[model samples]
Target chain A: MITIKKPGLLSTIQDLGRYGYQKYGVVVSGVMDSFSFRIANLLVGNEENTPAIEMTIVGPSIQFHQDSLIAICGGDLSPSIDGQTISMWRPIFVKKDSTLQFGESINGARAYLAVAGGIVVPYVMGSASTYVRGKLGGLLGRALQSGDQVEIGNLTELSKKVMDHLHTNGPAKWFVPFYKPINPIIRMLKGHEFDLFTDASKNLLINETFTITKEADRMGYRLSGPKLMQKEQKDMLSAAVSLGTIQITPDGSPIILLADRQTTGGYPKIAQVISVDLPLLAQMKPMDQVRFQMVTLEEAQHLFRKNETYLTDIKRAIKLKYR
Target chain B: MDLQFYPLGDQAVILEFGNIINPTIHKQIQVVSNYIEENPPDWMIEFTTAFTTITVFYNPEVLFYKEVCQELSHLLKNIKWDEPNEYRMIEIPVCYGGDFGPDLIEVAKTNGLTTDEVIDIHAKGEYIVYMIGFAPGFPYLGGMSEKIATPRKATPRLKIPARSVGIAGTQTGVYPIETPGGWQLIGKTPLELFLPNQEVPSLLRAGDRVHFTPISLDQYMEMEQTRS
Candidate 1:
């Protein structure tokens, strides 16, 4: 069990998100950075879909009541144990009664902490992800508060082996190198309504830089950039939107939909960020500048498959080391 | 049926039946959605249905983009459109006017009718659930009397209470959760449309038939108490 000493700015339990419920208007709320979340879970020998604590700019101060193996990934909020800074993207064994704290924004916007057995939360619609707006899953469908005691689930054979190895060896010498960038050029594919935009708007979309406005949250990031105008205003029937759909609002500013975006939208979307770059976009904070790069459908698919292969290789390497 | 396919992203594809929203297009979406729900492919993750389109999300690792398109095209041919159209008919009890519906007078005034006339017209109409979107269990209903149609409020309310029934343009819906919306509120429903604890969280689904029945405040209070 782990007790929350300080709940930070915003922290919630998340997995890969709740599926099979979008038809009912349920938003698929999950970790903002899937790449980091999956890596953190993998480092702790947990399944990639296992629930982990996702922290915003400010991270929670946690007190572990039992000996455990854990990994911290994604944004660097300067996590430390007993005043000593800890390494990320690698497993670390913490003794009982150790206090883990975070201070100062070092890099990125969100951080994920995964334990060996994953967080134990009652499944709502076959998921433990927190959809706060709907009050669906996670710990009572809300962010963590101070003094909240969360239980850990039983460890799998792989997790147990990893924990035992970590107990013998303080921390792994090797670590997965993750690129943390403040202003990133996000790659995207043309949306269904991409051709409907004016030529000037299409050119500006790829050439100009956009700043993430203060209105950014889990749902989406409202971008302040060159106004993108459609050739003609047409009434679009509401249709399903994806994780990285970039929708142009009535005011002409673009809003990139994220993890907690509504299943369907009526706005005309100009582009969809490729799967590989969604993690980079997720780590961006308010006021961060971003540029868009258009990629073909084939290129996007190729990149997605390459990323999966990289993750699969990492999993195999970790399993070999533990064995 | 004329079908068009577009790539939403690397992981999802949007199967658009037509550009316009009509009964024929809606039925086509329902047929495809029902078929996929009954026989979901291994590569398919899940899907979402809208007015004239059904977006199928899939695992890119399991199937390439071209393969996904091929599989869906093949599956579309096998859909059993001849199956009986068994839509669930649900009647919602609503208490109009007073504190429960703050914009009742405004809605009636916009429609050039009395509050009682507005309620009668709304209650008497038979509505169809076209799609559920925007908010969980929030039904996008069709088939409303144009006599009571009202434009959305210029400035949306920051917090519209849950279970508040409202009308916007030619559409009518019930807010299953509190959200910021521009729809003009005309009444409040006692039934809980979003049940998170249940296996099927949403009380309403696509292709369901819905109608509203006017109730007194006393009856509304009694039903609300029983539900709680």
Candidate 2:
């Protein structure tokens, strides 16, 4: 068990989240940086989809009720156990009664904390995720508050053996490398409303940079930069909207929908950011500059599959390390 | 009518039956949606339908951009559009006016009618479920008579209560969950339009017809108490 001494900014419990419920208007509100979430789980031998604490910018302070093992990933947030600074990628064994505190992130906005057997929050809609809009899921459907207690679920056999191994010696020498991120280039496919815009609007979108506004969240990012006018369409009937859908409102401002976006929308969508780049978007803060590039649907699909394959390879490598 | 298929993203393709919202086009979308659901390819993940089109998510490894479009076109060109309704009709009970509906008087005054006449006209119409969106299980209903054609609030409230029956433009619907909305609300329904706890939480689904029946304020209070 762990108790939150300080909830910190926007720290909430999340998992891989609910799928197949978009038809019912449920947005997938899981870990935004799934790449890091997967790494945290792999380090501790937890399932890739296990629930964990997703901290944005400022992480939390937690006092453990029992001795446990943990790993921190996503964003270069300086974390310390018992006031001793710890590395970001490596797993550490903490004795009972030790307090963990995380300071402001040096790079990126969100960090992930994965315990040995996932954070045990009661399931809602087949997921342990939090969708704070309708107050559904997570720890009573809200972000972590001070004095919240989270039970560690059934610890795996591998976790116990690893913990015991660490007790005799120390931390692992080399950690799984979360590759240094490259400058983002979001590849987009033409949206249904893509044809609604003039050719100049399309050209500018491909060439210009848009800044993320403070209004961004798990739902969508409101962007500013180009106010392109539509040539043909005025109002569009509401339709099925998904992650990476770039909607242009009547006023011509752009909103890039993300994990917690509504299932459907009425705004004209100019482009959809590809699936491979959506994880990067979840980490972006207000005023983060982003540029769009056009990629054919075939090319976008190819990259998605390539990324999925890389993830599988990473998981295999981590398991081999322990063996 | 020939359907135009476009790319929503790399993962999804949308087959649009143009921009018109006639029942014939809606039925066409339903047919295409049903087909994709029944005969999915190796890479197809899920399909969501709305208005006059259906969007399909597929695994790019198995289906290419041109392949998905061609596959859909081939099937759509041959598929029959006319069919009997595939859904059941359900009735929802609502408590109109008073605290449940703060704008009931405002809507009635604009239409130059007594509040009783307004309520009678609204409850009497059997509304068609055009689609479910805006909020969970919140139905976008058609068939609201022009007698209740009221504009939306200039400034939308941050918190419109769940199960509130409201009208905007020529459309009337219920709010499934409390959300910021521009709809002019007249009453609240005791029934849960969408409950995440239940299987198929939305009380109204696409293609299902619904008629609102007026219930007493006492009954509304009793239902709320029981739910708690």
Candidate 3:
């Protein structure tokens, strides 16, 4: 058990997310940075999709109510237990009732905290991730507040044994495989509204970089860049939109809907960021920069397959170690 | 009308029933939706509905695009997208104007009618649930009386309260959640659009008809208190 002393900015419980409900207009509000979330879970020997805490802008200051193992991942947020600095990308054990604090982030905006056995938030629509707009899932379907008590699940036999063995002295071996290299190139496929834009507008997308605006959140990242002009269109018929959809708003700004975007939209979608690179976009903070890379539909599909295979291989390797 | 499908992304395809949002294509969507729901395609996961189209999201690795297209073609040709309504009709009680809706006067003034006349036109007309989108359980109801047509607010309110009934273009509907919106506000409903604990979270689903009955502010507050 742990109690939040200070939930800086916005911190909410999340997992892989609620799916199969998009037809009803429910967007999957999962952990934004799945790569880091997975690594933190892996280090603590938790399931990849287990509910974890996602912190934006700043991490939480907390105190352990029970002796448990914890791992911090994503960003360069300097987390500390009590007063001493703690290393990320590794597991650390906290004795019951110890204070933990979060310091400044060097790069990136969001961070993920993984307990030995994930946080047990109520599952609404088959997920523990919080959907802020609808107020569904996690701590009354809202972000964590100071003084909120979060319970960690009972550990599996393996996690219990692994917890006892992990070091409290220093950072563990780097899991470089899951790390998103800074300045990532996001791959994208042409969206349905691709033809609606002028050829110059389409070409501008290939060349220009977009800085995520202040109007960014889990729903979508509103981008401020070249105002993409459609040859003609006063209002577009609303259509089904999914994650990674880069919708060009009427004023010509691109809003890349994230994990928590609306299920459908009326904005003209110029492109969709490929699935494989969505995690990178998810970690970006407001005012942080990004650039788009064009990829053929075949290439995007190939990358997605390749990524799934990589994850599969990693999972197999972890299982083999335990076996 | 025949259906035409194109790739939405690597994992999804959008089937265009026709350019127009007519009753014919809506039924076609329902038929294909039911067929696909009852007998899901090998690669298909879930499909979302729109006025004249259905976007299908599938696992590319599990089901190839070519295979899905072939299977979908057969289903599209045979299955009727225009099926009769399958869901129940729900009448929602709304309290219009005054504190219930801050923009009621603005909407009434723009429409060249007194607030009471606007309310009469709005409540008397029947509404069809064309689709649910934008937010969770947000029903896009069609069939508003053109007499009540009012332009959206020049500047969108930063926070339009949940259950604020509003109009955008020719469409009128209840705001399911408290969100920033540009719709012309006219009233508020006390009912919950979505309750996570409930088995069926949304109060309205696609194909569900909703009628707004004008009620007193006292009644609205009473229902709101009951739920709380």
Candidate 4:
């Protein structure tokens, strides 16, 4: 069991996301950074989809009641065990009664913490992700609060083996390097209504550097940059939108849809961020600058497959080391 | 039915039936959606249907973009559209006017009709649930009397109560959750549209037929109590 001493900013339990409910207008709320979330779980020998604690700009102060194997990934939040700073992106065996805390935000906006056994939370619509707006999943469908006691699930065989190895070997000597680029250049694919935009708007999209406004949240990041206007006003019926869809609002500013975006929207979409670069966008903080680069659909698919293979390689490497 | 496929990012594809929002396009969407739901492929994750399109989300790891398109094309070719339209008819009891419907008077005034006349017109109309989007269990309904058609409020309300029935332009819908909206409210219903605890959280779905029945304050209170 782990007790929340201080719940910082917006901390929620998340798996991949709640699926099979978007047709009913249910929002798919999950960890913003899937790459980091998967790595955190993998480091502790848990499945990629295992639920973990996702913290925002600030991080929670957690008190461990029992000795456990855990890993912190995604964003460098200056995590520490007791008073000593701990390395992230690798499995660490924490002693009982240890207090895990986070201080300065060295880089990135969100961080994920994974335990060997994963967090035990009732799944709503086949997911443990917290959809706070709908009050649907996670711990009472809300963010973590101070004094909240979270129960850890029974560890899998792999997790137990990894824990034993970590207990005997202290901590892993190496870790997956955290990746966060300042002013990242996010790659995107042309949207369905890409041709509807004026040439000037298209040029502005590729040329201009947009700043993530304060309106950025789990739903979307409202970018402040050159106004992108369409050729003509056309009434469009609401259609299905997805994560990383860059929609141009009536005011001309683009808003990149994120994990908690609505299933359907009526706004005219300009482009969709590629799957490979979603983690880069996920870790961006408000007021951060970013540029968009266009990529072909085939290229995007190739990049996605490459990323999947990279993760699989990491999984195999970790298994060999632990064994 | 003619189908057009467009990519919605790397993981999902949108199958557009037509650009117009009519019964024909809506029926085609429903037929295709039902087919996919009944016989979902291994790579197919889930789908969401809108007015004229159905977006099919899939796993990129299982299939490439071209393969997904081919599978969907094969599925569409096999679908039998000759089957009769099958849908559920749900009757909602609404208490219009007074505090339950703060904008009922304004809606009547905009249409140049009396409060009772507006209620009569709204209740008598048979509406079809075109899609469920915007909010959880919030149904975007069609087939309303043109006489009572009104534009949305210039300024949206910060917090419209749940189960509040409202009209915006030619469309009418019921709010399943308390959310900020611009629709002009006409009444409140006793039925709970969103049930988060149930296996099927939403009470309404696309292709369902719905009608509103006017109820007195006393009946509204009695029904509300029974439901709770």
List model 2 lDDT by residue over A1-323, tens digit each.
Answer: 99999998988889877766666666667878888887888778788888999998888999988988899998877899888998878778888999999986787778999999889988888888898887888899999999999899887877776677778788877777755554477778888778889989888899989899898888889999988779966877899887789999888789998867888899998889988877777777887888888887778888878987887886787666665
DockQ of each: 0.85, 0.66, 0.61, 0.84
Sorted by lDDT, highest first, which candidate order results? 4, 1, 2, 3
What is the TM-score of candidate 2? Answer: 0.94
Encode model 3's per-residue lDDT on A250-306: one tens digit a residue. Answer: 789999988787888888888998877887887787777788888887888777788
Candidate 1, residues A1-323, lDDT tens digits: the string is 99999999999999999888988988999889999999999998999999999999999999999998899999999999988999988999888999999999888999999998999999998899998888879999999999999998888888889889878876789998888775889999999899999999999999999999999999999999899999999888888998999999988999999999998899999999999999999999888999999999899888888999999998998899988
What lDDT does candidate 4 reach at residue A73? Answer: 96
Q: Put down candidate 2 lDDT per residue, B1-228, tens digits, no spaces.
A: 867777787777877787877777777776766666677755677677778778787667677778987877777766666766486688888899998899889899999999998899999998878777777787878888899889999999899988899989888999888889898898988888888888776777777788989999998899889978
Badly placed stretches (over 4 Å) of model 1 are B82-84
- lDDT digits (tens) for residues B50-136 of candidate 4: 999999998888888899999999888888897777899999999998888888888899989999999999999999899998888
Better of 2 and 3 by TM-score: 2
lDDT score of residue B90 within candidate 3: 93
CAPRI tier of model 4: high
lDDT of the candidates, in the order given: 0.91, 0.82, 0.81, 0.92
**RMSD of each candidate?**
1.2, 2.3, 2.7, 1.0
